[model samples]
Target chain A: MKVAITSTGNNLESKLDLRFGRCGYFIIYDTETKGMEFIPNPNKDATEGAGPASVQLVASKGAKKVVSGEFGFKVKSIFDSLQIQLIVLKDNEKKISDIIELLNHENLN
Target chain B: MFTIFVLNICSLFMSPRPSRLRKISNPPVISGFRPYGNKNIKGKVEAVFLHFEEYEALRLCDYEMLNHHQASVLMNVSRPTLTRIYARARQKIAEALVKGSQISIEGGKIYFDSEWFLCSSCGCYFNNPEKQVEIKECPLCKSTSFSVYAENNNNEEEEEEEEEEE
Candidate 1:
């Protein structure tokens, strides 16, 4: 499955409505092929509605799963519509590579 | 100094004829205020009320330290409108801290800012925590299988392209 991973500057990733207007970088991954790619978050300037834009960008690229520390309501809605999955990373985790390993583990379950 | 003086004079003249300065809006009022140094008292204020939009304005203007223009862009609002929101937020926060009043955040027209989805194929975006995501066709593209996009060395280049597009 195609997956997208995002890195955040902090913990406390809230619901998308509360934090939709923020943007960070994302890493796209494919579980079956173990392939990965990068896409610049176009919603970086957003402080409130970053969710919609971020989800749209990922959806446009055909992402099926999105791994990140937190997400907000708007992004959640878009992901719901596009059928994109959201993965919550542990608090204080910064490295995207570490999260990828976690994702690999989750895929097994 | 000169700008303030001109504004005062303009206000005096325009007060009688509102149409002359219809486009020039008044700066938002400070809803509350009190001295900060006297906060050692028993009834000291511990919080400040912030309207959602006003807090949004503060985040956009003060915390982010964005200029009115930049703030306007970020909030998807006009510079004048952002200025009004920022002014109100600063006033409320100042009042709460100075007057020893518990801040109760409220008011201001706000809306959800973004959209999202849960991938049906991977079950990544599903809301229910208990239910398992059943694999189907890829919801994003209707494909049975998919892969993530490759990272390109296009940060600077893409920024340049965006600027050009703008």
Candidate 2:
């Protein structure tokens, strides 16, 4: 399963971004293959409709699950309809590497 | 001139106001229900479409035993509207039971009320989006010491929002 995590920086050491829509980078981590890809958010500076646009960016990558500090209501409905799982991780100090390690657990359920 | 102005004002009142979106506290765990042992039945009836609002109305009015007015306030609709939805829900359920047709819950103008959980071990807040699967551990810390995060706090916040809107 591919899990997406919002990152404040392009590197794995960066803390998790608090805002899903305006995040700096979106890290697509494949749990099965143990691969990760970072995509800079195009809607990072958007004034409006950033959430939906970010959702499109994330969805297009075919990520089955998303990890973020928060998800907008509009984005939540879209994700719910797509049947993608949303994990709201509201820890400001959490790093991308730590999250990846957490995901690596055989029983992360 | 006065008569013309009166007629214009009457026309403005004729148009219906935009409806408020209904709030669903929780989605149904299962999508829909199917009838079994209906091979002896004469015909296959089309599935009954149960709106989320209707489901919520039935749940509040019948299951939770809340009166129409109380249910309406929870659902963000008028009392009469809640009664109407409850009526339709019962009608559809009765039809499904008698006719052996499937009942599908879907498609309504509604927004969700999020339920947040707090993990004591990790000191993190999380939510369970999938209604079927149970939350077993903290997503980050892998701890089972989590609790329902903000039951009273959320209620107070919602009440505050209601006051602000009013």
Candidate 3:
């Protein structure tokens, strides 16, 4: 399954982004192949409707799960309806690599 | 024919208004209750459906020992509305008990206050979208030390949560 994580930067060491819609980049990590793809959010500067637009972008990438610091009220229901699991991590200081490690823990054992 | 068209528009305004959405803090743990130790009828027994809002009203009033006014405030409904819901709940339960019918609890115009947890070891906050399953350990750090996050959406709910080791 592909897991999407919002990051503050393109690098693995960058901290997690708190805002989901306006995040800097979305790291689409495939658990099976251990591949990582960072896509810059096109709706980062969107004045309105960024949440739904980002959901469309992530859904098109075939991501089944999303890991983020926080999700807006609008995107939660959309993801819920799509049957996509949302894992909210409140620690904004966590690096993107650490989140990847946690996601791998389940697959490892 | 002209009068029939006007009557159709009049019927639209004559219907009663829909009920307001009740805010539920915590959903019931069990979906319903079943009666046992009864024998006679072999086939399936009749079921009494209990609404989620009615269940919340019962929990707030009977289980938590709150008055109708206080329970209504918790449920985001008026006192009289709470009373009506509570009355319905009691009536259903009574019917289920007397007739040996199953009590199935579901379906109501209600919104739940999302439940969130705070892991003490990792200092992370997470919400459980699936309310039925229990969270034993922290999803990120796998730690057991945690507490319920009392969201300050508007109410000031104070808690000094201390997790005990088993």
Q: What is the DockQ of each candidate?
A: 0.07, 0.24, 0.28
Candidate 3 residue lDDT tens string, B43-64: 8888899999989999999999
Clashes of each: 45, 0, 0
Tens digit per residue, CA lDDT, model 2, A12-90: 8999998999999999999888999999999999999999999999999999888899999999899988767777776
Q: Which ten residues in a row have the lowest lDDT in candidate 3 chain A?
A: A100-109
Please provide, for model 1 over B16-44, each residue's C-alpha lDDT reduced to its tens digit, 9 standing for 90 to 100. Answer: 63211111111124443344456466764
Which has the greatest DockQ?
3
lDDT of 2 at B125: 72
Q: What's the true lDDT of residue A104 in model 1?
A: 70
Candidate order by lDDT, decreasing, is 2, 3, 1
Which residue pairs in candidate 2 collide? Answer: none
What local lDDT does model 2 show for residue B129?
A: 63
The TM-score each candidate achieves on chain A is 0.72, 0.96, 0.97
Q: Which candidate do you rate higher for lDDT, 2 or 3?
A: 2
Give candidate 2 misplaced runs (Cα > 4 Å): A106-109, B1-114, B154-166
Q: lDDT by residue for model 1 over A1-109, one digit each (tens)? A: 7777665532223211212235455666787788877655667885566667777777777777766556766566666666556654333434555555555765555
